[model samples]
Target: MVHRIHRIHRIQTLPVTPDKAWDFFSDPCNLARITPPWMDFRIVSGCADHTYPGQIIEYRVRPFPLVRLGWLTEITQARSPVFFVDEQRRGPYAFWHHQHHFAAVENGAAVRMTDLVHWALPWYALPVRALVRRRLRIIFDYRQHALERLLGRAEQGEDACRA
Candidate 1:
């Protein structure tokens, strides 16, 4: 059996300060706010108000009808108002590494947020790879719109990001 790692890179600029962007993303509790409602995402345990190295955040998510999965991810790196990295410790994926980066843009008037994810499905899931990729795109697309609503819209003429 062979496994392949897939990557997704997305970037969005919002009309918010860097601190505000970092504050919202660094807290595990706000995840549900930005995620699509259909995912039925919820924090199960091991979550704190703020993220830190070695912080384990557990979640229960329903990706399909009448199905539930436990996802556990550890914050391996956290740099305030800058970037954070999380890696999966257990759950659906064969591997998952997600990085969230934030930077001030437009001379501190706005924030440019970047999401880079590296993930792979278990061998058994290989047959459904296309479906998985499409599902992920839908999830991230929902997230982008949700964030704009929660945080604020991007500046006019700003480049939109797609997964």
Candidate 2:
């Protein structure tokens, strides 16, 4: 069976500076705030104050009813207040690489945040793309709304979140 790579891209603008956005996102503890309640996501350990290369973060989450999962990711690359990349060391997916980028806009009055994820499922789960896609949509949509509610929304731009 051929393992297929799926991609999700999302862009959001927030009424805050790049520094402020980085301060919140760089801290691993803040992940729970943007995650959906249904996921029951929690940081098990290794949540440092800020992200850096080689940092490991551990998390537990319920991706489906009656199912719990452990997700371990390593911050492979981080450039302060600009971009960071995290790759799953162990998790539900066959592969997971997520990149987060932030830029100052409107003369530093606002921040534009972008998320790009490249992932693939195990061979056994390859046929369930529809189900997986729906789940991902829900999770990302919730994240977008949650961030907006927390940081105040700026004018939204193109959203290319396709799984």
Candidate 3:
């Protein structure tokens, strides 16, 4: 049976309006731009105009050396400029659920972005915890940096990454 395994929770505040945050993030095509190059992440199909619930996104990713995985994920939920959730339909993991949340702070001058991910590898991959923590941190760190650059970087409450 696939059991609950681990979670990756992160929060990042940016110096941008809620609208800007929503617009950039809601655009599905920008994913490849933020993802790390080594993963060889490529989107095979998805909508580019706007985001809505029940969207199916397909991709090809090389999660590890020489093993290419075809990932199919569904946008299970989306609530305008507030939050959205994506759950894996098929992939390397036994289960994967990711939630992206955004909120306006500083009276529309800044926004906070939070990502909560619950994921699990197969039972045989039990030893992955030790190695994966560091790698996932690296990936999220890169994402944070990319978001900061993309959203103009928060000069005020620049929280020291809570990944």
Candidate 4:
């Protein structure tokens, strides 16, 4: 077996209270809303409520043409208005761990999302590393853009009403 490790850090600014930010970000179903519809990502389960420790979220995503993939992840730790950690229970990766953190900043709140994932193919580890690295970057970029759009919409609604 081979080991490929990846780490990503992203910071986002949102003009919302910590509770509100946590409420929006911690909802697993909101993930479907943020993900690009072209990817055909759908929540298979765990959309009933907000996250909690040991809660599992299942997803179906068509990342490539005519190929659908299933991912199962469980929340390892959860602390409201602070942070939570989730790891893959079963999925494409051999190992996947992600930590989501939130904090209050000057104007609103700043969110720090990090992922420490390690994955390798059954036999072809080297080539898989290169391919997976690029894929992870693209996935995270999509997530960042989606969060920005959500925050932008919330801000705009606030501005419109105030005008």
Q: lDDT of all the models against the reference?
A: 0.89, 0.91, 0.84, 0.69
Error of 4 at 4 (Å): 2.5
User: How well does candidate 1 score on lDDT at residue 59?
Assistant: 98
**Model 2 TM-score (2 dp):** 0.95
Q: Write the per-residue lDDT of candidate 3 for residues 103-134, one digit (tens) a residue.
A: 89999899988899988887887677667667
TM-scores, each model vs. reference: 0.95, 0.95, 0.92, 0.81
Regions of model 4 farther than 4 Å from truth: 107-126, 153-163
What is the lDDT for 121 in model 2?
92
lDDT of 4 by residue, 1-163 (tens): 4364555555555556778877987899888877767779998988856889989899998876797889999999989988888888887766677887776665454433333444444444566566656766677667767766776423322111000
Candidate 1 vs candidate 3: the TM-score winner is 1
lDDT of 3 at 2: 83
Candidate closest to the true structure, highest lDDT:
2
Ranking by TM-score: 1, 2, 3, 4
Provide the lDDT at 118 for model 4: 40
In terms of lDDT, the poorest run of 10 residues in model 2 is: 154-163
| Selected candidate, larger TM-score, 3 vs 4 | 3
Clashes of 4: 0
Residue 9 in model 3: shift from native, Å?
1.0
